[model samples]
Target: MSTTVEKIKNIEDEMAKTQKNKATSFHLGQLKAKLAKLKRELLAGPTGSGGGSGGAGFDVARTGVASVGFIGFPSVGKSTLLNKLTGTHSEAADYEFTTLTTVPGVIMYKGAKIQMLDLPGIIEGAKDGKGRGKQVIAVARTCNLIFIVLDVNKPLAHKRIIEKELEGFGIRINKAPPNIVFKKKEKGGVNITNTVPLTHLDNDEIRAVMGEYRITSADIAFRCDATVDDLIDILEAPSRRYIPVVYVLNKIDSISIEELDILSRIPNAVPISSENNWNLDELLEVMWQKLNLVRVYTKPKGRLPDYEQPVVLRSSGCTVEDFCNQIHKSLVEDFKVAVVYGQSVKHQPQQVGLSHVLMDEDVITILKR
Candidate 1:
């Protein structure tokens, strides 16, 4: 075990010499800590027959991988949407309780692999441990984003029941609320009508109106380009959290062109037909843009550097120095300067300072010495 630890450290050192990336250093530290923990466990030895309850210790799951979970009432096309997004057929049906277990699938979007989990549908009394709602809630806690699917055809009462169940589950939903996807619409068309106060309508009424349009209450639009400040006004007037909510007016194949145009006009409303495979790509692109992601490519030297692969960073209008700091703390500390190359200019190395803002496709080499 000690030899193995030494070997790991040597490998990390070699990597540090070759590539100056912050993520690599952080990962190396994690590896060292894990190795230390294993050594300690081994040294402790034979606690109730050399392994304890299960007879063998298992590794805890590592976090930090971004994941999204599908959550909503039963029979809201959660499974169908998951299949469409991830191409992992997780059994879709028209009836309630079709999804008995949590299904996980991965979809590649904007050059990143995103894990999407389809959790069991939430029902009434879920928070109080009725209808196995607690189990569903447990599955949701791991997700970075929740896709709250709502049945437009279902009664508003049922929709309220589901929302209450979610509140009862006590999941720390983001300030940016989960995206809403409406399902199961008839052939005619759904109307926007008006963006009413959530407090004015009971759950049943909300469900009725949304069902007519095949959307969730969250999908209703407010003018255009509604910023966070504008959302705060909407939420305060009605007294709700100001979270960014996107509406997907799904089942477009069944709707009319005029209705589709109406949906397009609605702020952040995307019309998609997952069954006929329409507008899914556009929907994904829109989601990515809303998430505010910027792509940075790591040069493909002889061998693809595992730790230094292309990274997607949260865009904040920062310069190349900011990017370097995000990549690794050591690189920032030892930062002498950087040389720019590739894409925008010829491979002629241009010396740059820490304040140099990077453009897309600007290949950079750091001179750590």
Candidate 2:
């Protein structure tokens, strides 16, 4: 039996040689699904692995609410940025692979304790279990946000290569999951339906992917103009993560004015000189927006709202109950209405229940029963 990497290469080679057209749609879809499964198996296998958070010395006590991971080719100023921004020093050097483990740091940005990780620099073919790249990428997968730190002087293709590596490890950077509802049932017989016209996918391709996974019964509802890859992503949802990424173009002080202008044009990219601490404010601002964090102020009974330290919550689940639970586990069980005052509520100081969602800078006073 060939190694998993060799098997993956074979499938990829076959896929590359196969012509993509309506005549070969089913074959291509099946091949794609097989390729996806092989990659997933490769990541899950014990090939010098890091069990998610990180392996061995690389793991750190996860501090803060959300984590931001630094990933890129070696010596891209990840350590320098981590040290400068958070005042926590990681090893920095002139040579490559200076940082060998995950250096954890924290910064209080907009009242949210955002954890920043200076991860070990990953080389090309990282996803194929090369060196300690597997563990590095595994840590990155768990991050809420990833910073693709790149040397401004390096070739732009570096960005593409990093993206490809992350994608291979089932990290969907800066992309949302497909708006397709896919559910597996015992005897539904693979029903496929669509709300909008799908220009990139057909029933044949969908059936082929499902067949490759041995999924005989499923209900797939497509709400967007999805592609075959989107279908595969939905099928491989367990391993996939939809993460937001910001391309950090480092060493901009060495680049020309025109070159800096060009690098700024890249969407979701921030160009800065980490050594000189230039344009870092903009980077943090952009990071704040991408984080989508909400700050809720606590207004004690018959007292003014506390602005010194607001309770931080992510927009994904920023409910009154979540706020209560964050402060104290027993607070939610009191079962009282919460008085709120902020943009989230329609009126000033409106009374809401535990289920009411909180917003940024919202003032809340939990009234006991």
Candidate achieving the largest TM-score: 2
lDDT of 1 by residue, 1-369 (tens): 455336534654654665424334344333333433333333223451212121111111323335666777777677888898988888998888887777778886756666777777777766544565656765564445566664433324554575555543333233543232223344444333334333222333333433432343343443343322232223222222222224555567775788567656755656676677788787777666655555556543343333344565554355667778778878788888777654434456577778876654456667676
**TM accuracy, model 1:** 0.51
- At residue 170, what lDDT does model 2 achieve? 92
Compute each candidate's TM-score over C-alphas.
Answer: 0.51, 0.97
Q: In model 2, how many backbone clashes occur?
A: 0
Clashing pairs in 2: none
- Across 1-369, the per-residue lDDT of candidate 2 in tens digits comes to 899899999999999999989999999998899999888888887753433646787777888989999998998899999999999979899899899889999999877899999999998899997878888988888888999999999838899899999999999988989999998999959988899999998888998998899999988899999999999998888889999999999999998999999889999999999999999999999998888889989999999999989899876557988998889988988857999998888999799998898878899999988
What residue runs in model 2 are displaced by over 4 Å at the alpha carbon? 47-53
